[model samples]
Target: MINYRPKVFDEASKSHASKKLYAILLAFIVVMGIILILESIIPAIVSTKPMLEEMNENGYLENPDNFNFQESMKLAMKVSSSPSAMIPTLLSTIFGTVTAIFYCRCIEMRPVRSMGARKEGFFSHYITGIITGIILMSAITLLSVALGVNKIEICHGVNYKVIALYLLGFIVQGMSEEFIFRGYLMTTIGGAGYHTGIAVMISAVAFALAHAANPGFGVVPFINLTLFGVFAALHVVVFDNIWGICAIHSIWNFTQGNFYGISVSGSNNTESVFRTTAVSDKAFLTGGEFGIEGSIFTTLILSIGIASSIYLIYKRQQLQQKKQPSQE
Candidate 1:
């Protein structure tokens, strides 16, 4: 019979101890610190000339006390659309991959492929994820439109090239997140003798916590984000790989911000093919400034997705068992 147990749970014996997992997690934190420092430093250096001129004209530097964190983050994202954004984004993923490798290969004494990063079927899974993401996000958009919760207008003079760059950025962003949360954190926790389902819940909680500080964040978005994590973990367990979830996460955000002109997790995307206008009074339905992901509909959709993924996993196992020879 086909086993429904996750390979990660089965491979727990090969994993490092709890202490080692903590150290590895600390290493990841350090790497993230380095990434944040570089992201800030490089951008500051590039903008030094303008900043200096503005400071001189104003007779003083901008006051830190009056700074708005949300607005600043949005502005930073807008500015990062240029080539410069690639550095931090790429570094984040590369360093994240390095951390995973260090733990899997060095600490755990296992092959990196044991972490479900095998190249076989990578492209196919990624393509499937992209389609899945498109369908989900499009459905959410259509529902909002039908209910008069959102108004979407086509932007005639859209810059396809910029949109392409943003797509690349979101792809990297999504892959990095998947590598950390699904590939690294989930595997580590599950391989530490904990139940794989528990690991999934923990990782999902962490995923939601990471985005807790995002703009327009609310209870609905928090729950939806957690559900997304559970869905992604189940996806990995079913497919035995991470490529598909990475693609889904990437395309989901990209379509929300770049294709549909919605605020992705509350970060405004000024460049898009469509301009989305949310009904001011329908924040519960339209997700307000947090975009559609913060809505009740998103919760329903994600719940369905999670259940479907679980069903598919079991169904696939049944099919595989049916193809085997009888013991008799």
Candidate 2:
């Protein structure tokens, strides 16, 4: 009896979006292209000298013959680990948000509000999401420490400036992915007459596949990422807005990388307040090179989050049903 799709889903359906698969493919091309262009141009403009210096020091220049995939990846990691380079890299994600919004709003003629860009209660929802994000991540980190899978140490000579930059960058980066995946993709599919479960599953799978190229991305990481997608999608459905998910995504990444000094989804560590290092070689426990996001702990937490969201959706549906009788 619990069945109630959000207003945004119905709104998107009324827009008559193109066939789901075709829409997803075209949007992928458009959004990825913009992100690629901005990612390349911004880094080139902002971190050109520092990147070159790092590359040369890493022997990329002196030993061109030996520069292989591993060497290339090493250089890439160095760039990502550097705050100046990472800022531009992260900031470029805004294009992903913009491209998805433009495609849905202008091309499909869908209203922006249909994508959960609502103004009412935006601040409240966002603040709540931030709190939720901090708690979830803290639980994972703390639990890991308690089990002796990881150890935390305060960073010496920490650069508050770089940490601030990362915080700003993660805010944009997190919101971009939410807008693209949850706000745009999931709703578009659901609105096109697909079952809500199908919409959520497809979007979740797509999210996991998108991260396949990252370092240390294995089966566990893929599962964890997909579960995260499911959690986020359900949260959106229950809250009936995108702002909460955006804040959650932003704070989740910020807390993981900047607050805990852990690698963010297989990326190298950046400026963090405290460094969390693995005490064991168990990939299931420490997540190996992918960081805690890939660990079994993440799987457990995301599963709980998913379950909680499902319950909320059900309760909301029940409340609506109770009101229907009075109105009649």
Candidate 3:
């Protein structure tokens, strides 16, 4: 029998699937959904961070009745900004960890993991992440070229230090998202059932839809984002862990935004270490309105991602099975 302990309801130390698992998932999704809908209606409902309210309480947002569109956009963006580190950490532990423990109540997982107090560490799985990110970025870049939306000029410049810094920024961006989504969300959902297909699909959907509000919203980007979800879910199934996928996501974004200097998902990354000027003609290749991620090549890359994830997962399973009889 599989031994699992989700810290949601049971007082006993004995391992058993928590009865509250489904109820918890359903309730949280519904609540999050409602909150999102309300946010669309009233911008102030957007983020849980109190900073916006504090700003408004001060003269930062006085009689906005006299403000123009740009001012309004700034306010709207502010409402959705991230919270202070202390608050987010408190919430992640109280909320994010709880979701992880409960949502993935299906799998026989460890009550405590090697991921420690810092909530981060040396990415042992960093290599796999970089490969995955590179694959995705390459595909997107190729499509950008074909579409003529923008062109890229690779720098053979002697400024290797700038290039290195740019790459590091990319790594951080990919790692952060991967860690949060694939690592955090995936393992949490594993408790429900680690080896099953359904758990993976759920994670992927969550990953994709999270980007719905990004500046460029068309069918392709949405589809691409959904594919990202699928990619992330499958990635975790391979290692039965989250570290690799996090690095991939952070690096992927960093590369797309910083190094390429092309619009990343339609948003320009002027803050990136390297400044890249647009260099293409065909909007289709340029990914036109949606950015490189909006291209069909992105789909191909995702297909590869899906295949790689499956292959890795199968190999891991085989290794585990091979060890099982020896233990016996």
Candidate 4:
């Protein structure tokens, strides 16, 4: 049986403020450096000479002189959206993992596992997270359909290999964000004597800010993203592990982009099983170009998720307290 003593939380909450602050600064510098390096190398690798030649031959560049840097960059981004882009995206997760390790070892003087990477209960929690994510996303899609804000068309002859690649890519994307926000920032801040509530809020806000530059981002999307952050943090607290939240994050994106054939945070995957069309007059419900994640339905579902996490945590605490007397 898993112990519900909050041991990881206690250890993380004991981090020194000065050390945590310094670690945060160092992590920021390292992550930014890594991103800049990868941004330069990955684009060049993905947008090779042959690819450009093919584009020109295919009449994609009818006016070569008109193909400015912006257009070239757009082509690069399009190419990078494919499954072949996995390598570059995976590199991002590596950077995040390295930053977390640096802070845990050098600053907090604790094992990396203390950041909620414990192996116990990982599989079960991860499966639960996957189910939860699918249900939430399905709910949002259904709501949109019912409201006449979106329509879905079935896509045939889907390539399973591409779907597999997207799954892997989304897994990397999801876990990377979780490691940075819930694992590193939340633990470091909470460990530095800040209340758990404060840490969760700070981390959630940071998560939202991190995606502020995405195309088509707006007030509703920003609010919904922040709510997602809060829900993820609460999920970690309830399960006392990061595995579940990682699964949820990964499967959520994969389902949105691959299964439902909808854009995820303003980015669309060319290989999808369904084609979702947004009603022109219902941007608020359909989330328009920003995808279903920006819809009000998302906010409602995530709020319920947050509340559910809180309830589960409370119930677990009570059960643990009851078990204490039995042991005595």
| Top-TM-score structure, candidate number | 2
User: What is the TM-score ranking, best to worst?
Assistant: 2, 4, 1, 3
lDDT of 2 by residue, 28-111 (tens): 667666766765787777766776787788787888888888877777677766776788888988888888898788877899
Q: Which stretches of candidate 2 lie over 4 Å from their true place?
A: 1-3, 20-23, 325-328
TM-score of each: 0.82, 0.94, 0.62, 0.84
RMSD of 1: 3.9
Candidate 4 local distance difference test against the native: 0.76
True lDDT of residue 78, candidate 3 = 46
lDDT per prediction? 0.74, 0.86, 0.53, 0.76
Report the lDDT tens digits of candidate 3 across residue range 151-228: 566544434554455455445444444544554444444543443465456656666677676666677777777787
> What lDDT does candidate 1 reach at residue 42?
52
Give the per-residue lDDT of model 1 (tens digit) for 114-210.
5678789988999999999998888888778888888899999888887887787788778877877877777776766666677788778878877
Q: Which structure is stronger by lDDT: 1 or 2?
A: 2
RMSD of each: 3.9, 1.9, 8.0, 4.2
Best-to-worst order by lDDT is: 2, 4, 1, 3
lDDT of 2 at 326: 100
- Highest lDDT against the true fold, candidate: 2
The clash count of every prediction, one per candidate, is 0, 0, 32, 1
Better of 1 and 4 by lDDT: 4
